[model samples]
Target: MSGRGRKIVWGLVLAFISFYAFLEHDVRGRFAARQSVEPAVIVPNKALAPVMAMGFHNLWADFSLLNAQVFFANPEYRGRIEKGMIFREMIELATTLDPSYKVAYFFGHFALSSYWNNWGVRQANEILKLGWKNNFDDYRFPQYIGFNYYLNSENKNEIVKWFRIALRYPEAPRRLIWTIDRMLRGADTTNHIHAESMCAMCEDAKEKEQKRYFCERCETYTALIALNDLRLAYLRDKGRPIGSLGDLTAAGYIDKIPVCPNGCNWLFTADGAITSSSLAESSTDVRGVP
Candidate 1:
């Protein structure tokens, strides 16, 4: 081609590229703005999610899991206990898309149940029950069911029932039998149980970080129990509620308020109850203690 013709073609090409870039940027900006304004919603129907995945179901499942994490991490979603957060639906879709996704089941149970004062415990239980159904040979699901029941529902019978089922599994964590024994022996509280169950869980932890977490949790629970006992004594002696951890020190209940190993301060509830700030609302160590 002639130089003039080639220059003209090059100019047109540049113009087209610039226009395409501008259009793409505008479209992306509008899409982002729309996403920011729209409420987070999930397709609740599990059966439809696979169809939506269009043969990339596992990738879709992974996307759902990541999306759930993002949704939970959003600052706007924090401290909001109301339903329709789509956490449950996202997890449900994930597990439906890939039934063998063990992490999804575990994360779904932990996140939902621990999120808002056991508000999602029932939902977590549903996920766990599905996990149990799909992964029957794995004992963790039944064990989780027992723990959730014990911590959230305070249903002794259900706790025992699920624990027994867990124990029956060959792959059950060794802590299951200990938990059953403790529960049967009337060691309903941490004081009576001696943190053995917690320690067992810590020992059973496979990852170094998980082991550290469980050990720290055990220490925190033990500290909470001791603090609770002191608070009870103060209540009995003074005939009033303990206002704060300092009150325990001021009243000569102890030399000083014990520090939580988790680095969170102990919380003194208005009802004269002592709890750990680090523990979740559905934690067995936090619940049913005075």
Candidate 2:
């Protein structure tokens, strides 16, 4: 086959794999519902990956990335990832086994930071940090690292100091480890820094596709940030929590609910927390709480 033919073949192969995985999950989810049992998900022990790799670490990393992509699409199962069952572990396994897996780092950044309520900032930054350590020449990773820090404004000084320390000693294992520790500890909620990052990525990213992706992600982030900010404002002004996401619009805080760039709908709770169905399964906790 020609080089172009080979590229096309691999593209189809990956698409097929992703589609099959999605279908299998869909069928299994329905079956599990009928059977009244939990969907069986097998996640590897990230720490034991080296032993299990048995000289196929690179291949294992690729598989981990695929799994990460599949799981990231279903926010319902994100709890599994958050509760230490899948999402975060897969990213770690992929990057640790194959530190140069650039896509995994990028994928992790978006997947981990899907929560506007600050659920995945720590995980996203950790992935970004790992990428920065291994692929320091990539300015995008460092730029994003700084952007994620903007979410947690109170710890700005400490994060700035340690983040710079990490930048200075990218190759030092001990220092990088400590800096990552510091970065994870101090985050609050999302803010409207999305526009800045979005604009910066548009100007700096070389690829058109990548620029578009960042554009959508930033728009989504701005929506979430607005939701978080106005959620409080509604509480203070109305003397109660929002009755629904529409309440924000009804109250004139935002004109409309921003559809997620990921193509999944976002969810709102009465208490004002923002979660993404595109990032996780639609939340049931919201209805139960009220």
Candidate 3:
């Protein structure tokens, strides 16, 4: 071809490339905006998911797991807890697609239970029950069920039932076994159970940093137990609840309000109950305490 003809062809090619790139960018931007405005929907029935995955079920499960993790980690989701959101559905779909995916079961229970309200606890229990049924040999599932029961339910009978199930598995952690024994004997408080679980998690930590972090959590929970005990004693003696940590200090409950090892302040609820910001499950309101 002649030089002018070649130059003209090259200019045409560049223009096409630029136009394609601009179109792609615009399409991506619009899609992202739509996603941001409209929250994710829950997956349909679990039975249909594997068929929809088209033989790449594990890959689809992994994608669902990733989406769940990101959704639970999002601050907006954490704050809102909106109904019909994909939080529970994604985890359920992931586990349904790959029942043997232990990480999905574990993370689903943890994230759901961390919501620390009745609805969240019920959802967490459902996930843990599925985990227990599917992964029977793995004691963590039943153990988490027992723990959630202890935390949220006043039904001692149900607590004992799940704890017995967990203890039947020899692979159950030593701390869990101990907690169960304590609960059975009426020697453990909720704080003690929380501390024991934290200590158990600390023992399982492979990294020095993780172990240290869990150890700190153990200390904080323990301290909160002591502070709560003091509050109870004050109520017994004065016939009224202590108003705040400052009240405890002024009344000689302690030299001062004990500092939380987690660096979050102990919060006083509307009922004058003391709780740490770090322990979401410890709220009296969520536990249905009068």
lDDT of each: 0.67, 0.62, 0.68
Instruction: Indicate the TM-score of model 3.
Output: 0.51
After TM-score superposition, the amount by which residue 159's alpha carbon in candidate 3 deviates from its true location, in angstroms, is 1.2
Write the residue-wise lDDT of candidate 1 on 1-290 in tens digits.
99999999788666654543342233444466657754425344677666655566786677778867877777666446654246777788789999988899999888877775566676778899998898878888988888787667555567656765675565665555545544433435334243555555566666565567657766876777788888889889999876666777888888966667756656544454665666434323333222
Pick the winner on lDDT between candidates 2 and 3.
3
Candidate 2 lDDT over 163-238, as tens digits, reads 4433443343333423332333324334333344444444544445655655665576666677777888998999
Q: Which residue runs of candidate 3 sit more than 4 Å off their true CA positions? A: 1-45, 83-85, 181-290
lDDT measured at residue 190 in model 1 versus the true structure, 0 to 100: 39
Instruction: Give lDDT tens digits, candidate 3, residues 1-290.
Output: 99999999788666654543342234444466667754334455677877765566787678778867876776656634563145888888889989988899888878877764766777888888998788878877777887777667656556756765665565656566446544433434366665665566566655555567667777887787898899999999889887666667778888966777756667765566676765544444423221
Model 3's C-alpha root-mean-square deviation from the true structure amounts to 14.5
| Per-model TM-score versus the true fold | 0.51, 0.44, 0.51
Candidate 1 pairs with clashing backbones: none
The lDDT, on a scale of 0 to 1, for candidate 3 is 0.68
